[model samples]
Target: MDVKNKVVIVTGAGSGIGKAIAIHFAKHGAKVVVSDINLESAQKVVDEIVTNFGEALPIKANVAVFKEVENLVQHTVANFGKLDVIVNNAGIGPHLLRTHESTLRDWDRVISVNQTGVFYCMKVALQQFLEQGYGNIVNIASLAGLKASPNNISYSASKFAVVGMTKSAAMEYATKNIRINAVCPGYTESALLTQLINAKPEMDAILKSVIPMKRYGKAEEIADAVVWLASENTKFITGQTITLDGGTSL
Candidate 1:
């Protein structure tokens, strides 16, 4: 699992799971690119890394936009001299609503950031990987992707697309030494989860009761899995979705 000296990029690294991933990668000696739409937030993460004597660079990017995604990859390579791995951790959750109640505006926003954003990141990263002959990608999906997520049509749809895209891209680049994989987390303790719980207070108990573990996952736990997937130890693993839920899908 040694990732020392590798140049890695983590999108939406300003907070939550992305923040943990960026910090964890840096702790393992990877040169991290902390990317987020909010430049201030991204810089804060970078500051934390620098304070701990870890290497990091802050770059603001909106994954939904192609030009920004392109610049993110370009800027990372320009600063680091090479790109080794990219973690597509940027995503947005939609309001909990059934398909009939969902608005086109909400659906588009979710798809743009959660689905198309992953595509843009992967496309740009794959281009760089092809030139370098080897690279790794880890996408942060959701448990709703594999199982039915009632009342959250947009989020579920976008995450399912991520899972499919991860496998498809992995197969396409398998022989090229490019590895692609995704992690589907369930009811993690993040701002997104908090928002959901706040929207429907009953969801707090409802979610935990379904999980065999009777608890929510931590951001660091997800980060650890991501680091392992991106490391050499999992070099043979690709096109797989690792569910990090506490037996909720079971």
Candidate 2:
């Protein structure tokens, strides 16, 4: 009952960590808005939530588009009556390639979604939050945002920007009852990771060797952190990046 009756919006919620986060909030009595680029996938999550007797709404939206993000917020407020939490969970990882080999298009694509998209969502959500006088934003950044990531130039750069944006925006709204924070997940168990491991079978061992815990973090684990951040229990916490890497960054 931590978030009971709260209206939550989760982007890229069709699958992976986004999906898990949406479900977690619903279970805790939140009215979730499942937004994703894939309409079918978003509807599936909505169907599941509805089947479970939880309130949910599905919307197909690409966060990269500011107009689309605006509509997303408007739609959520129309359906749910208000917006309490906005989880900027929609993001993409660029292909693993050395900086020199990566093209301008590659960098642009990653930045458009991972970096600029977050800004669009945050800006629109902040507008709504300011009017309401209260809001919570939990951006899903990566551990790579904290450190250098070889062969992932664009992704690293974009995520680093996300981290900086989170901190700066958090400070701007810190005293306004609007809390903005981020979660830096290391190697997490998800469909994307599965594809990565499948492409390079040796990555399995490499990950275990690098991560001190010898395991990847679960989607649900990250979801737990996100839900906690969205709750009022951490009212004193803001502008913080919770790293859930299991000592990998160390």
Candidate 3:
């Protein structure tokens, strides 16, 4: 809600959407906890936030790991003395293969990071919320979650799972003052998208053509949606998936 002194943890704060979300939340008066697998990268975002007079803490955590996720929440609560919001944005969509061509390892990695990782992050956050009687969770899904991306089966499935998880969690906690929602982003010019575009030009064009807006969505635009959803602006909202997908799902 009112984020002035609220403590917020954002996973995958190393770069791209996560970095943008972390920066925006900090700029908007939230005390942000910047976490990523890479400590240096997380620190960079934290540095910028603090340099600009916002408060932040850089913590290296692998959200896919339960213990790490638990400690992450524990440390954030310890540092800020209260928990208000958690953005489970740490995910990987590296599977660029057809279903039959995909390996179990690829599927496992994508599912673990994109789907199960969100579960772990929220589990810890939910525990604290149950104890304190309030909390908000915003998950980063993908446009692929709402539609099929034939080649990237694992990625799409992972995101779809996130969407389902978001809804279920939201409904379960709605009466308990906990809100859970998801933001589904379309193709953005992140390193992951750039790599995919470079590898398959025609496929990239096909992907863009699906978006009625005819262009890639900006990371900042998605960040704006996330901050608003996490802010006091949408306190009554829960069990919702905010699509920042440039009309791709339509």
Q: Top lDDT: which candidate number?
A: 1
Estimate the lDDT of model 2: 0.94
Q: How far out, in Å, is residue 90 in model 2?
A: 0.6
Clash pairs of candidate 3?
A: none
Overall lDDT per candidate, in order of appearance: 0.96, 0.94, 0.90
Candidate 3 global TM-score? 0.97
Backbone N/Cα/C clashes per model: 0, 0, 0
Off by over 4 Å in 3: none
lDDT of 2 at 32: 97
lDDT string for model 3 (40-82, tens) is 9999999999999999999999988999999999999888888
Error of 3 at 214 (Å): 1.6
Shift of residue 202 alpha carbon in model 2, Å: 1.1
Model 3 scores a C-alpha lDDT of: 0.90
TM-scores for every candidate against the unseen true structure = 0.99, 0.98, 0.97
What digit string (tens of lDDT, one per residue) describes model 1 on residues 1-250?
6999999999999999999999999999999999999999999999999999999999999999999999999999999889999999999989888899999999999999999999999999999999999999999999999999999999999999999999999999999999999999998999899999999999899999999999999999999999999999998999999999999999
